[model samples]
Target chain A: MKLRFRDSMNWLHTWSCVVLGCLLFAVFLTGTLAYFQYEITHWMQPEVEQIQHKDKAINQAQAYLNTHTENAPRWTIVPPNERFSPIVAYWRDKNTTGRFSVARLDEQGNEINSRATRGGEFLYRFHFDLHYMPVFYARWLVGIAAMLMLVGIITGIVVHKKIFKDFFTLQFNKGAKSWLNSHTVCSVLALPFHIMITYTGIVTLMLMYFSWAMNMGDGDRRSFFSAFSDQAPALKASGEKAQLLPLGDIYNSAKAQLGHAGIGSIIVSNPGDSNAMVEVYENATEELTSDYRTLRYHGVTGELLHDSGVTNAAEQTRRTMISLHAGRFADTSLRWLYFLSGIMGTAMVGTGLLLWSNKRKQKMNPRFRIGYKIMDVTNLASIIGLPLAISGYFAANRLLPLQLESRAEWEIHCFFIVWLMAFVYPILRGCKHSWQELSFITGVSYLALPVISIFTTSRHILNYQFERDATLLFMDLLLFFTGGLFIYIAYIVWRKGYEPAVIARPKRPPRGVVQ
Target chain B: MTIKAFLQAISNAKGMQILWRVVLASVLGFIFLSVFIAGVASLGSALFHLSKATLMLWLMLIGIVLYCCLVMWIFASNKLMRCSVIIIAGIVISSAALYAGDMLHKNHQPVESR
Candidate 1:
């Protein structure tokens, strides 16, 4: 066989991807789901669905702050939006160090339930935080994996020269060829998305690893930040003694100046101080830039202090990248597109790993065979096993004893314990047996999630159906479909019978050796 | 080229390709498998042992040794004294580093606890 540098790189690309593919798949899957975290949270908590009138929610938040935190150090209030019901207020007391209190608000600015959580936000955080690892380290590890992925993408493009020409190709009938074709189709179709996601993921954490670049370009970090962001200097006030001011005036002033855009949030600094600032951020619906703009006011005097224009081009570009990754600005159709692209990204990595394992098993010795088995176990554990575990977490939430000590921790522990078992089970039983067994287990577990939810929670699908709580129904149906996909994969594995792949290794001799 | 030389060339080529794929698979497979084990063990140990630093030190040490072994298989030509010496040295160095980190972390645990 003639060796080309291009071929070697292609080989490099294939192996690098196969090596890091499972991690990449997990990242993409979780990240995509995280895009609709608000919606998912809304769906999960049926009671909070579209309850608070927008005006009322804001007023309630204001009243609550006036009563409970009139002299608090700082107050941040996130008003209710079309998608969410609970008006949120977060504050820190001057005496307490690094502690913040969270509460819901009514239109009169009174506190509602303080305990109702930021639902999908937890999942969104989980995508980056990951389970069982320190957040910073998890991100660093993810970043390295993503960089390897970027290498794989570039090399893959070079190797598959005809990829562009056969961009739309999808062959469903020819077994392994069909799988390869679908893989190529999914990968090539959303090639740009894959590239953007990988690049942006790295860029998001650029400052952490590459702050020296900023320090080189600009002398100090503050100057570097100020060069891109025109954040106004905060107002200063003297005297510990201060008086409460009406929030309504500042809120109205910001709305009038920003035009048409309602205030999504307001942050009051030194709330009762003479130079207190009230920064009003606009709502999501009015302008595309509403999400980005801020109007600063004198909280004490209700005087308009300063207003930053919606966003500079650079800021807009950054926001757009974040929005694309977040899927926050997208409607239902576009959300689906983001999801499909993410699925494709996951499939691309998954197939790459499968191809790697398939190509390797032919010549591997028994000792090395154990390594392959470990890989297979993890592949099943993370890719097929995690979603199953998350479902278990939710089920545990509904089913576990609420009065139990450290209930939340126990719920999370169940998830990890089950996942750990899944990871090790493949090692104990060997790859083939574990693969078949766990895929079936995952399928059955996911299938039971909604049933368990209905049994445990007061609200049933039928009740939700009557209430026209479409979001809840949608989630339950998605769980069912996920179960079906698992079963389908399990059946395929069963029918095929798990053993070494049938493809023979290429036959050739060295350049100078005798036969 | 002679027929014998050509035939020998073909067989050697086949062997090299098979060896390359096998080595690549084992390396990639081992890398992933190790990371996953390390990751899971870190979390489990954190709750159980009240610290995960020890588990991480062990993982990093094992990883370096495994990596050195893989490189020797892929690149080192001599199947004689060199391979044994290199592997032995790698194991010793990795073990030493791991032990140092573990001891240091243990000694400093009280400070961190406070």
Candidate 2:
């Protein structure tokens, strides 16, 4: 039978989301939290105090490395920025474990024993590179999820009627209609953000999904990546040894040459060799594009060798798209905006999934099939499970032994284990009562995290000064607000009566349309 | 149910049609997209004088939109046979053009080893 485009779109949107909505919700929520990744890391590793002078920190870092790993051929320093997290240093040496060493340094450039946790970096990577899975499969899964989101947004727009009027209309406690209204309001409020985010997110790693595109390419892959680095075939280690110049001097010269204060990272190839080359990478946080403006310098002589920055319009567009998706260039205020829009995206997907299940249940009235039970359980775990898992991750950070072997990996294990329990609990209790209990448990766990940290760490919530320890304070307050919000949800579910006591089935559509 | 009855169930058409759409949209859709990228890159090289680096810069970035557009079109239209035929034909033609281009490159750079 022939159907209107919008009718087909409605069907497409429903089935597509029904299949991929859980993945979309997890990605949206985790990715939204990743906006404050740096701040979260700072909170997680409070031992690394804020630096007064970044240049001095760089110089002191170089000095520490010079004295400590004198024989190491290579060194790379990821300098701390406005976030005030500990700087990371990597060096290559034959005697080291895994042929390399990585150390966290405080503001004074001394090695510090920060609690071992992947912190927000894990959450950020988890958004795209899921856990307990190979990177290849994880990326493909995320890529499909992004594609689903993009299609869902498009089809939703097509099927929506009276869009402007619907945005202003939200009828509370009206069963499926309420669900529909919440979903519509959330989608309409952040419509542009949803489109831009999904499109740009897919572009960031589309090739992974379309791996066959690699077969169609004719040129060396390095050429495509050459835009990031302009160094003419890195200077190999020479037999003859020479004294290397102070890295502080090179940093100064590079700053003078580039006239930019935002130095992101510094890489030194073949240290103490005559052919030593130092590459200073520009942070370029002030720019629209996330292009890596590299300045290669002669390590011994401190002479400028190469600088690669300019690109064609197409390349510029590509860089800008990626930068926009990552939002690394955004200041704190704009980052919060991205974060809030992401929350709305998560809410929109949640309500849409609920509406789908609610509508399906209404249609099959009084005959609750096992299929419908499984559907309810799936929704319960996906919507409530993930936040429960996230809270578990934070709790593990404070509760786990500081010196536990591979402490970081175990924190993640705790997260997944709790997530598994989230599913099991709902199934055991049944969906009807599970929503309130699970959310309440999740709420209590989140609230308990800041309290846990108070005794575990040197600092507490109120002890942290706003100006000096803003990240620490923000993290505590965020946990409190999130906990309170979840508790409020539990109350709402309890009051409204979970599992919608009665929902009127939508009427049959006109002839020639499949509704 | 017997095999005949099961076959009849499928031939009732709704279930089988969706399964066909899934296959067309995923496996064949990927092949179509790959061919589409190769075809676009080949045509761009022949026309624009852009380096492979610059060409790929645009190809991979914009290829996402093209892929989404193809998926939407595949699902929106009910004509499955036409979609499959167009996809297979596009692949064959694009492969032939790429093969021809490789031969031409070999002729020009006979002394340069692959």
Candidate 3:
């Protein structure tokens, strides 16, 4: 038996996708949404209004920090940005663990207690960290999935003979042929985005994948990272007490130096020590590159010390790739492109999964093989179930008692619990009914999100507060459109019905059988 | 070739051969990538004036690209035994290059300093 390269690629592409398609779907969906994570966070925490003044917020945050922990070893101040997060101040006391305590400030320069939801942060971490698993193992698993996706994408390109020409062809209702067309169209629509996202996603975790890269260095990771990355070298306190010069002075000097670029964050190391150093990082919005400009100053005197940034072309290329993946520099319009491309990637994976089952159903005798059942269930659960589970997460954020223990963790719990229900529903009710029912339920649930907000919070869609800010209105419109799409899909699935695409072929005599 | 022609050739693969290829590409391909990175770094030290960090990073980027291609080649090649031999030969040759390159760099460094 002999196989050519293209034939082998087809087999590799199919099986690789079959094995890892569900995981890839989840990652692509979540990661794509994370492009709007800041917007999502704004929606989840509706009470926090936009800041009218950036510099004033910084001064207020510093004053508040002075009142709270005067002699704290370190303090970080992040000014309010277009992302809608308030002025945030982070600090760590000597007695506390290494974790910094976060405080949110409103326009009035006073600390405000918003509802206790992880907000967009949970989605951001979930894309890579995952849940119900340790971060170490989860990262490894996600990394492996990313690598296989790269394989699938490359092999997929090789296997499709009319890959480019198929961009013009579509047969809407031909069952298996339609599924193939759907997969091909989605794949072709955003081929570059899929390839770039997969490759850059892997680069984000490449250090972990190639941990042996550490040995090539001269055993000094701190200096190596500082040299190649944007971090300043680590500093320790002198233990001699000294007052920090007003942050406003340092901000003014850095502002003059930075010109048009706004300061994104200010970190002061050893605030009360003689050797205190203040680090100011330039905002990411000024450039598409993730390697932002940095200015370090003497904490007491407010003199500019040094600027830390990418040293050479190699590091710059690496940093740019990561920045492209994160999309942190994306403005409103570019973010929409990212979101739409993400939707395309998710649809590609979804249709690929469905296409697998459809192809098998056509070839095999229609019976209850565990493999078929599992495939059909996964296809239904993942494509339809994920949106429903995400809605459950949002619902939990609104409904859970604010004072409940570990309320944030409970929100994530709601997400997984709903997801598990989605997985189980198909097995009990059978895939045919389950697909339509779950999609319909998911659609209504999403449509009901705005209604739920009306009852649970002060800033629902019907309320007058939306007139003050359009973020919630934007979110509500998005939810309604998504709900409408899901409903349309359910209708289509109901009309077409889930009958097996059984192609009746005449059987040939058994080859080389001894009669 | 058409899709039909390409798919007909898929019937040529055996179950055992598929399993062997998976292991050889994933596990052994990674080993080759690691050694290849070290080999490039060592060889780069004598040739380029770049810092170790920059050298390692660029070599890693190159190594991963090569590894992705190698994995594809491992499956596509009809000669499965030959693919294994090539991977093994890669490991051995890269390891030797690393050793010899390191020695050359060490010998070359002092004279330049003087």
Q: What TM-scores does chain A show, candidate by candidate in order?
A: 0.86, 0.91, 0.91
Clash count of each predicted structure: 26, 0, 0
Sorting all predicted structures by lDDT, with the top scorer first, yields 3, 2, 1
Better of 1 and 3 by DockQ: 3
Candidate 3 per-residue C-alpha lDDT over A278-341 given as tens digits, one digit per residue, 9 for 90 to 100: 9998865656664467899988777777887656888777777887888877878898999999
Stretches of model 2 off by over 4 angstroms after superposition: A63-73, A94-100, A223-230, A365-368, A500-515, B1-12, B107-114
lDDT of 3 at A365: 59
Task: Indicate the residue-level lDDT of A201 in model 3.
Answer: 91
What does candidate 1's lDDT look like per residue over A48-71, in tens digits? 546445555565666777678645
Docking class of 2: acceptable
- Give the poorly placed runs of model 3, Cα more than 4 Å off: A67-72, A108-111, A216-223, A226-236, A262-264, A365-368, A464-467, A500-515, B1-13, B105-114
| DockQ of each model vs. true complex | 0.02, 0.44, 0.37
lDDT of 1 by residue, B7-50 (tens): 46744675664465445434443434344333433343434553
Model 1 local distance difference test score: 0.64
Selected candidate, larger DockQ, 2 vs 3:
2
